[model samples]
Target: MELKLYRAGWALALPAVRMLLARRGRGAGMRFLEERLGRDWQARAPGALWFHCASVGEVMTACPLVRRLHARGAAPLLVTTNTPTGARTATRVLPGAVGHAYLPVDTRRRVARFLDRFRPRALLVCETEIWPELYGACHRRGIPVVLFNARLTERTLRAPAWLARLYAQALAPVRGVLARSEGDAERFRALGAHRVQVVGNLKWAGCPADPAGPPPSAVPYWAAVSTHEDEELRLARIERMLPSDAPVLALVPRHPERGPAIAARLRAAGFGVAVRSRGEPPAERIWLVDTLGEALRFMAHAELVFMGGSLVPAGGHNLLEPARLGRAVVVGPHMEDFAQETEDLVEAGAVVQVDDEGEAGRTIARLLADAAARRALGQAAAAFVAARGETVLEAYLAELHAARLPLDRAPA
Candidate 1:
């Protein structure tokens, strides 16, 4: 009954959702709209593995997996993302042969159109995507579905009973769950998911080669990467609290598209700002890194890197992105999203976790003042990531083999 209500709710809200998509899909052209509606002119050739990554973060993290799959020459691969930004990341990062599309809205009818057209053999839903209709439709077709890099946060575990019931139903058809941690596996089990296994975090083994180059400015700077809007005001406060000429702050907003607004906000707050997407040179106060796919470059060059999404209610982003780069990384206390990664890094002194923006400011100041200490933290981060080894990909491939997935043969 709960699942039925959930679908009905989606059905009723779909009109408004279409308006919302229209707004989001502005200037994206007609194909974006077509794909989101589960009907597109792009006739998908059926011989390909399919992966659904909901957003930019998942799309970026899925690169390593996609590359591994692409290398095997098993089949053509198709990746669907919910947002245009996610689609862009898939296009930019995934190999040229891979296909990209906007995942249709999760109504049974729309999802059926998508599934029927592609006829995917197996579907790997990245992270926490639990679209009931999508899962149910795939299951009805006998498509093997796996939840990759799966996690069930405490916050999500505490969802209302109705949601829990709906999720349990959604997960029923899921064949396997590749959890990122034991705690995650336990939570999935408690939530009624079957065949859960702890396969480690795939983001831990991110891009092997960094596109990092020299720091944009000769002036020493520290970066706050993937920051949210709410946290932007806090960063403005933190910057004001710092000394007259503290290392220039490289403020990289989580959504590069928001760079203009963020830069305006920081400027109105009385800071000199330079917009990178506009080709402006680095400013004395803040360098707004508003471009996509270049976060690692700034992170690699900064004196110390502060991760965004942590200081605010927004769940933290891929904290390990910078950690793997061997940079002095710090995050705010709200790291519920990446708790295991933060915990592991904190235990090894590879990353600093603070209670609030106040502590973050102090930590940034202290680290900026003491280069040797910052370098020590960076070295520890490097060592910890090195210790994690490169087995996550192999572990996932093994899971496929155990499931009797014919990676090297035509789909049966």
Candidate 2:
């Protein structure tokens, strides 16, 4: 009943959704547009293990699993993501995968077209993308679906009844769930997900530091990374509250496409800014680190780092990205998305947690005054990440074996 209503709603919204997708996908190329619209694009051979990632974050998070699958399995692999950035990352990170495409718009008709194109043996989803039409179609077709690295936030679980009904219906069809935490498992169970298990965060094992790169600029620089909308401004303000000269500020917005607009705002606010996409060097006032795939490089070079998305209730990005780089990391109080990591790191004195940007500035200021103190914090973080070991992948593979999924070398 709820599925019928949901489909009806999507039917009404389909035109607008297509327009939004077209606008967002500008310059992503004709193939990108066609694949997303449920037409064109190369078809996959039957029986591939299909993975759907929502965007850049999920694609990156799934890197460890995808790489493992690519290395061990003879079965063809296909990855579909919701955005162009994700497609580009899949091309970069999971180059061995046989095919990558945008996930079709999530109406029954479009999703059915996509399924017919791929004919996947099993569907593995990353994180919290719940599409009722897609799930219902896959279930009706008897395709096995597993959600790994899954998380359900408290706010989402407690959504109003109509929305919750749709989610419950979507989850009911999932064959298994590998949750990131026990709390997440419970939340999924409450949402009617079956066969849920706490397998720990895959990201903990996925994103280790890359070999350190040359400094982003000659002067020492610090980064506020994965920042969402006004967060770039908010974290950039940390400079004003600093006691002495802060390191050159790299304001890395989460969305690279927003770089030009963000730089304009920074300039209007009386800060000299340079856009990375424009080949602008670090400006005197603020160097807007406006490119994809380089946030970690800046973090690795900096004496201090701040993970964004926390100060403005955007939950927060992965803290472990910089932590494993042995950089002193700080974050604001609204890290609900990474609650466990935030708590563990804070308790261990590995990451400094503050209530707001004001506290963040003060926290960073004190750390700047004492080089030894910064090193101690960074070392603790790196140690904590290293101590986590490599269990998530093994356990997740075990889950696959137990589920009768053939992940070993494909049948001859």
Candidate 3:
């Protein structure tokens, strides 16, 4: 009953949704709909393995799993993403994929058409994308579906009964749900997922090898990464609190387009700033990394790293990235999105936790002043990450093998 109502509502809402997507400048998703409506999907390769990633972070988290699938002879991979940035990253990182496309809209007819055209043997969804129509279409076609690196927050679990029922129905068709943590696994079970398992976060599987390039700067530096609005001003003030001989600071905003404004603000605060997009390096006191896909590079040269989005109300970006890079890490108190992971890290002495910007400054200053302490923190962080086994990927592979899916190697 809930499923029928949801389908009816979704059908009625699709035209408005399309208009909203166009208004929001999601040209790639719009183009995909146009092509599908024109029956252009008939021209693409069929019966490939399909993976769907929602955005940039999902793309990064799915990268290692995609590579493993490809390495295991999963030929003719197809990657579908909801956002242009995700599509671009999929194309750039998973060149082995036969093609990339925007995920078809969630209407039953459109999703059915996509399933028929692609004829994928299995569908792998990253994170929390629970589309009822899409899952139903796959189920009707007898295609297996799996959710990897799955997470369900408190907000989702506590949704009203009707909406919760809709989610339960949507998740019913999924063959397996490999959750990022035990908490997530319980939530999936609560939503009526049948074959849920607690698999550690796939983000811990590993990041892509650093590209071959010189360090962004020779000077010792500290990096503030994936920062959100107003975080730059707060971080710059924190930089002032550091001792005169502290390492240079690198500010990498979550949205690179904010670079010019961030640089201007930092300059107004009496600090020398250089914007990376403008070909500026760490020559100044603060180097604003106004680019994408280079956070790891900047992190490599940092004495310590501050994971952003936490100081404010944002749920915090990935702390594991810097931890994997063996950098001493600090984060503010608002890590609700990563509550379990952050708590575990703090308990293990793998990270420094601060309540506010002022505490962040003082904590960073103290860590910077003690080289031995910084090194110890970095070591603990790296070790902590290493201890979380990559058995999730292995378990996924075993499941695939038991199911006897096609994984013939693709041509090099």
Model 2: lowest-lDDT 10 consecutive positions: 403-412
**Top candidate when judged by TM-score against the true structure:** 2
What does candidate 3's lDDT look like per residue over 270-313, in tens digits?
98898889887677777899997888788866889999999998
Candidate 2 lDDT by residue in tens digits, 24-97: 98988777778888876665556678889999889888887878777775468888998988888788777454
lDDT, residue 293, model 1? 74
| lDDT, each prediction | 0.83, 0.82, 0.80
Which is the leading candidate under lDDT?
Answer: 1
lDDT of 1 by residue, 1-412 (tens): 8878888898899899889998999988878888898776384648558888999888876788888888888576889898888887787788888888788988878888887788877888888888888888878888888988887777778988998888888897788999988988999988889888999998876855546787677777789999998788788788778897788788888889998788788778787888888888775577788998778888888888999999998889888878877789999998877888899899998999999878988988898888899999999998787667367777888887787654663455
**lDDT (C-alpha) at residue 3 in model 2:** 70
> Which scores greater on lDDT, model 1 or model 3?
1
- How many clashing residue pairs appear in each of the predictions shown? 0, 0, 1
Positional deviation of residue 271's Cα in model 1 after best superposition, in angstroms: 6.0
- Per-candidate TM vs. native? 0.85, 0.86, 0.85
